[model samples]
Target: MGFRKGISILTISAAFALALSGCTSDKPAPSASTAPTASSSPSDSGEGGTDAKLEALGLDSNLKFKETRKITVEVYDRGNDGGTKPEDNFYTTYIKEGMLRDHNVEVTFVPVPRWTETEVINNYLAANQAPDVSLTYSYPTIQTYANMGGILDLAPILAENKELFPDMFEYLTETNIYWDQDPATGTLWALEGRLNVLNRINTFVRQDWLQKLNIEPPTNLQEFESMLRAFKDNASTLLGADADKMIPFSTSFDVGWRADHLTTSFMPNDLTDKDIYVNGFDDRLFLMPNYKEGIRTLNKWYNEGLVWKDFPLYPAGDTTEDNLMKLGHVGAFMHNWDYPYRNGDDSIHASLQRLVGPDAAYVAVESFPNDAGVYKKFLSGPIDRKVFFPATNKEPIASLLYVNWISKFENRVFLQFGEEGVTHEKLPDGSLKTIATTGEKIMNSPANIDYTITSNGINLGDPDLTVKSIANGYAGVDSKLIEIAHKITTNDGRIGKNANVGQIKAEDGQGQALKEKRDTILNKAVVAAVDKFDEIYDSGMKDYLNSGGQAIIDERKAAWEKTYGTETMLK
Candidate 1:
């Protein structure tokens, strides 16, 4: 079946999507009102001093407003085609309408396709037709615009409405804001955004196949190898007549997704750990000894015929692995827990369950102990992008008001869901649920906005949600897999350091180059282990450590010293 059809099976049923009656928490008792008054004057309290009269528009705040104005805004559309609507465009209509209706500020939304978000936005800005606010994903882009004086510094606005934006303000302060300031100079450019801590890679296997072979889930590396061997052997027997029928184990390496996840197995520590700085530098791109070990593991798997030879060239989103697993051909793969749950497809989940019965499971695996025994989890920041305002904006206060209006909870929800009763409903259990208003349920309906817009809050590091979302629909998932995943914590000592100084200078080009180098070295090492482990180690392993590896350690050491002082570095 086509990938789209395969995914449709997992899509939320229209009935389920529309039936949004979840429990609700009792509303909090009203507290003494200390809300700030809306003022047009630049003197409004905030980061920088303001004396100019402020013209506010969009959603009116609870605080009384003096005057209101209407403005048109162009915003990127994140909703899929099936659910596209004027109000569904959160950045354009939803936010604009909420601000205008609530705060007596009128705003108009212009939708831009995701494929042309950057291009269309830049073009508009260049043509002096910029919107009040523009959204972007990359931090570097935001920094570039901010440095060019193309965007307003929100610091003052944030300060002025501190109570109105405690969570947002806290997020900005706790995370690094991109701006340049020099004690020696005068002002620095800084960027602000949310940080995501947990890296999403995890192990996915055919749990149903495990039960068919009566093999237990793998724990350490040895057990994992044993399971792979069984998978290969069983596939050989089942497809004894067909050479192409055997699916030992496989994953796509196209676009670096599969390769990156595979490399994580050899990580001696959590990639997020800051302890193992390069020599004395803090750069993480530098090579480390553990990288060699990871490569060796991959080499071993390849030589043993555990990994598919054609993996490196597979097209992304192709059904090769999915079909194999569904047909009970492949044994295991590595992917994020949410892969099976999203994109309006649940066939992967359904196929696994039907084939395996109840043996399918999802698990997370981590590397061994480090000096500190503390595993560093990757964190995501709040600011996905810096909102850029054009220098040509006749009234920047309108933009500020627009932003402030949407920052409110009610406005945010409106931007996410159309009319609550129409698009969704609160469940008896208080949990929010999605509902399909149209004939077809949108894959990422506004009801799912929390996942797409807001950063994971309490959901971070949660294994249960992980399993339920990814593996539960499949039959093979079990407790043993969860146990294995939970045991894998952050490793601190084995983290890699950035040592590619020459490459770093090239910016984006350098980042891609270093990644290619690392992958090449690692891939070779992994395949070599089946022949002579020693040869693999000697060739790529030693050179990587001695050259790039040592530099990384040195860099990390220096960084540690700077952060903790000379006395701590000595210890």
Candidate 2:
């Protein structure tokens, strides 16, 4: 669904870039005028004021629209594929057209080639041709851009335009740790889009095969191992010499998809060493005990042949694992809850039902208990996919009115789902359904309809609608998934709190060498401890903890005292 990162030179390069960007520079003091005021409508004049026409439109409250008489916006085109029809290409016909005709806004789509590097985009920006908005992968990237003054500090705009972007602003303030405020400057550099949670890393198994073998879905690690062995043995008996065709488990290790789940099962703690409680501080690298246990279990599983030996070499694009699962030869693997099969729309659940009747059931394993019997919880970051804007046209009142008009629920549904009678028709019941193309009733249609309209740069409609459409379906399929998703606590509770780190600025390349040296040693020691568990337990692991780990703890204590005026370390 998204790109993956590895422990490679690229990561090192990114760290170097962060260091060169002077992420540790102290934040400037907040301007006294930055405070919120009752008369702070964008129409008042100066950098923050807007015309009365725009003030009526609702643009005055949040955004300090530039004094430029005309607003021309630039955005990236992320959904273009070669052979895509204009209507079929949601970006072309819907989003751009809707914004121009309805909102009376001038916008340009800057289409970057798919799979282009970030450097290319950054270089374009450095040439004074950067789009008003751009996509980023992490908080570090946001910080880098903000440090270079390439991006806007969206906090004030977000605060003022709460009516238009209520859910989005709320989610950023309540859910995202990176967006936390800087205590010194009282400014937020960037807005967050979404968080990735553990629900997406579900485990899928061959329900049809389980029925044939009269095996129940495994609940715990012990039972899971037994089931795998049983499947292997049964396949050997059934297929004779071709028993290897019946793969008990298969997964691609290249992208770390399967590896993440296995690790999660063993070590359910939050993985990042960064202060899950603070934003801008040195990470507590390799401090979690469960990390070591997780790696050791993975090694054990690899040595025992429970996992496929060829996993390390598997190409991410190959569908060998999915093919085997479809053929009912694979017993288990890590996957999304719904796995695609040969039939385009058929999913893992549907395939099992077709192959072995309706008696088969699928189980989603969430966590495994340690010796203390506590179900260690593991969660990923929030989905940072979409963002909103405050209308900042010269006619500030007009912009606000436009935003308020669009914020209405009726307009939101239309913008998101399209004209009820054309793209979709309401069922006899209240629920909406896609219209039949050729009078043949279609149960489900592609959900990309809204993506086309919203992809247009100037449209600042509610993103919550999109989130609902994406998360609601799967959420209904399994409640536990959503429950676990909500429990995923960010490192910092919210963006305002974490923004404090931005106040501590640094010189170019000053933090680079130190960061590299720290990360290198940490990675080497952690990898060694995981790879040579027996030796590490006897020698390096204990010594490393007493030496390096304690030093990190001391550093954290000092940092905490400086930031919060407290000394709160155990040792």
Query: Residues 76-130, candidate 1, lDDT per residue (tens digit)?
Result: 4554545545334433444545565555666766666554466566666557576
**lDDT of model number 2:** 0.41
The alpha-carbon deviation from the true structure for residue 543 of candidate 2, after best TM-score superposition, in angstroms, is 17
Per-model RMSD to reference: 13.4, 11.0
* Index of the highest-lDDT prediction: 1
**TM-score of candidate 2 against the unseen true structure:** 0.60
Question: Per-residue lDDT of 1-571 in model 2, one digit per residue for the tens?
Answer: 0001111232223323322342322334233234323322222222322333234332233323333222323233333312233223443344445544545444444544322324445455456554333443324434445566554444443334333433333333334413434555655554444332223445555554566777776656777777777877787653456687766766654323454444444543343334433322332223344544555665565555656656544443455565555445666776543333212224444454566455443444433444434444333334343322211112322222233333344444554445567556554534454332221221122333223212211122345433333333331134343333333322112221222323433322223333334334433333343456557533544564354444444554455557556422212
Give the range of the ten consecutive residues with the poorest summed lDDT in model 2.
1-10
Runs of candidate 1 exceeding 4 Å displacement:
1-52, 55-93, 103-138, 141-153, 156-167, 170-199, 236-245, 254-289, 314-329, 343-347, 354-407, 410-429, 432-441, 445-571
TM-score of 1: 0.60
Q: Give me the runs in candidate 2 sitting further than 4 Å from their true place.
A: 1-88, 106-130, 155-180, 194-200, 236-242, 254-257, 268-287, 314-324, 327-329, 336-362, 380-383, 386-561, 565-571
